[model samples]
Target: MPLLCHNGRFADTLDPVLAGDNPSFKWGEGLFETMRMAAGEIPLMHLHWARLQQGLTRLGMNDAALQRSVLENILRELALRNECAAAGRLRLHLYREGAGLGFVAEAAPLAAADHGWNERGWSIEVFADARIAPDAYSSLKRANYLPYLLAARRAADTGVDECFLLNAQGNVCDAARGNVFVVRGGIVQTPPLSEGAIDGVLRRHLMSLLAAAGRPVQELGLTMEDLLEAEELFITNAVKGIRWVARFRQRTYAHAVCKELYGLLGQPFNNALVAP
Candidate 1:
C-alpha cells in the first residue's frame, strides 16, 4: 500500500478525511508542488519551498515555518516508507481550510504529501481554444487547472503527447505540464514570467547552468512563428529534468543544444539516464 502524509501525520492511505469541508475542492483555493526525488532526497527543494512560500503569502496563509517543517518531516518519512530512497516523486498540496458553498472563516491551512516511487519525451502541439489569464495567481501551480486539463484532453484525443497553452495575450506561456523553451541559432529563449509561465524549479536551475556555462539564454517573448523557426525546442519540469520536443505539428526540432545542456545538468548528479 502507498503511504501518505497529511499535515505532518503519516497514514496508510491517501484520503484526506477532512474535519469540515475542503475549500480547495469546493473552490480552487489551493497550490501544489511536484518535485523530483533523487536518492531519497529532493533536489532543488529550497527553490520549491521558496515558491511555496510565495503561494502561501499570495493566498493569505501564514505559518510558513510550521508548514515547511511539516513537509520536511513528511518527505523524510514517506521516502523511507515508499522505498524511494533512491528515486521518486514528491507532491506537496496546500489549501485553505473552510466550509460551506462560499468561503467561510479562514482557519489554519491544511496540507498533504504524496511520496511515490518513479519513474517522458513528448510530441506537442499548440492548444488554441483556451488561454491562461494573467493574474497574481497565474504563476502558481494552483488547483484551478481547467485549462490544462482541457489541453491534455485535446492532446490525448489528437494523438499527441502534450499541448502548449498560450497566455491571454496569445504568447506561448507553458506546455500542458511544464515550461517551454525555444532554441534558434544556438540561442535559447523562453517566455518570461511576465508571460504567465510558472516559475519552474528545473527551469530556473537549467537557466543558471546555461548561464554559468557561458551559453546565451534569454527570457524573452516567444510566438508560434518563433517556434516554427527554432532549431530546437524543449520543456522542463521537476519530475522530468528536460525533454526535447520531437515534433510540434508540421515543425520538427533537433536536440543538439538540448543534448549539451542535458549532459551539463547530469554531470553533478551522475545521472546519465537523464538524456532523452
Candidate 2:
C-alpha cells in the first residue's frame, strides 16, 4: 500500500483524528498540486511550486519554510515509501489545519497521478452537462473538483480517455484533468486563463519552451468548433506530460506537433521504466 504522510511525519493513514468538521472534507477549502516524479526527482518543480505558491498566497497561507521542506524532503520520502521513487506521481494537498467548525488557512499533505500513461494516443469528447466558471479559483488546483470529477466520469462512461470542459460562457476551457491545446494551420492555440483554464505546470513549461524557440503558441479564446476543426489536439498535465488525441467525435487528429513538443520537453515520462 502507498504510505501516508500527514502534516510533516509519516503516518499509517490520513489524520483519522481530523473531525468531520475539517474544512477540506466539509467545504473543500484547500489547494493541491499533482506533481510528476522521475527517478526520485521532480523536473518541473519550479513551475509546480510557483503555481502552488500563488494558490497559497490567495488562501492567505505564508508558511514558506514548511512548504519548501515538504517539497524537498517529504516528497522523496513518500516516493520511497510507496516504492515508486524511480517513476511515480505525487500530489501535495494543502488544507486548513486546526480550525474548528468553519474554514481555516493552513497547508496539508495528500497522496496522489498517472505513471507514463501516454502510449498510442487518446480519444476524447466534450462534456456538456456543466461548465467551469471563470474565476480566480478556476486557475488554481483547489479542492472544489466536482466538475472535473463529473467530466472524468463522462469520459469513462463514453469509453474515452478525456473530456473537454466548457467555460461559463460556452467556450472550450480545459480538459477533465489538464490544459487543452489545438493545432491549426501550424499554429498552436489554447484558451487564456481569462477563459478559465488552469495554470498547469506542463502548460507553462510547454508555452515557455515554444516561446524560447521563437514559434510561440497563442493563448486566446477558443470554442468547440476550434477543437473540431483543428489539425491536431493534445492535453498536458504534470504527471501525463503530453498525450495527443487520436479521435474527438468524428474527427481524427495527427500527433506531429504533439510528438514534437513532447520531445522538446525532454520526454519526461518513460512508462516502460515504471514498476508494475
Candidate 3:
C-alpha cells in the first residue's frame, strides 16, 4: 500500500483521505503543490515547500509535523522507486488531518502536456470571462480548482487550446493553468503578482532567467488592447513548461519568444542558476 503522511508520521494502511471526509474535499480548506519529481527526486522541492508553508500560514493551519513528514516520506518513496535513476514529473499533495477530515497526497501523475496540443504550433483565445481572484486564498494552490478546471473546459469545447483569464480589474493576470507573458518589441512582459496571478514555480524560474540574461522580462499591468499589439504571446506552467500562443483575438504572430523560454526549461530546473 502507498504511504501517507499524517500528523507527523507515516501510515501504511488505507490513506486518511480515503478513510474520512476531508474539509479540503468538501470546502477546499487546504493548499497543495504540483511538484516536478524527477527520478523520484524533486529538484525544486525547497521552493515548492516554501510556497506551501506560506499558504498554510495564510490559512492559519500551518503544521510543522505535516511538512516534515511529507518531506521524509517523499525522500523515502523516491529511494524505493529509484526515481533519481530516471527523469519525470511527480506531483504530491497535503491536506490537514483530523477526525472526520484528512487530506491525502494522491499517487503521482504522469508528466505530460495538458495545454496546447501543439502539433506544429499552438492556438489560444483571449477569453473575456472575468474571475477576480479571491483575496483570502488567492495565493494558495488550494483544493478548489473547480473554477479553473471549468474555465479550461469551456475553452477546449470552443476548439481553443486554452483561456487567458483577466482579473476583475480587467488586466491579463493568468491562464487556466499557467501565467501569461506578452512579448513585443524585444521586451517580454508578464503581469505582476499584484495582478493576482498565482506565483507559479516555473514562472518564477523563467523570470530570474530572463532578468539575468538581460532579456527584459518586465512585470506590469496589461490590457486586452495590448494583446492586439503583442508581437508574441505565450503561457508558462510547471507541466506545460512554456507554450507559444499563436493567436490572440484575431492577432497572429511567430512564436519567437516562446521558443526562447522553452529553451530555458529544456535544460534543467535550477533555483539559483540563471542563464541565457
Q: List the RMSD of every prediction in angstroms.
A: 6.2, 3.9, 5.3
Worst lDDT 10-window in candidate 1: 103-112
CA lDDT, every prediction? 0.73, 0.77, 0.65
| Residue lDDT tens for model 2, 58-162 | 877654535565456777877787776766667777776743112212221222234443657899998989998998678988887888999999999989999
Pick the TM-score winner.
2
Better of 1 and 2 by lDDT: 2
lDDT of 3 by residue, 147-248 (tens): 577769878899988888878788878888888888878688988877878888888888888888887578888888887798988777775567777776
Candidate 3 ranges with C-alpha deviation above 4 Å: 1-21, 68-87, 99-103, 108-119, 127-130, 134-136, 266-276
Overall local distance difference test of candidate 1: 0.73
Task: List clash counts for every candidate, in order.
Answer: 2, 1, 4
Q: Name the candidate that leads on lDDT.
A: 2
* Candidate ranking (TM-score, best to worst): 2, 1, 3
lDDT of 3: 0.65
Model 1, residue 144: distance off in Å is 1.3
Model 1 scores a TM of 0.85
Q: If scored against the real structure, what TM-score would every candidate get?
A: 0.85, 0.89, 0.79
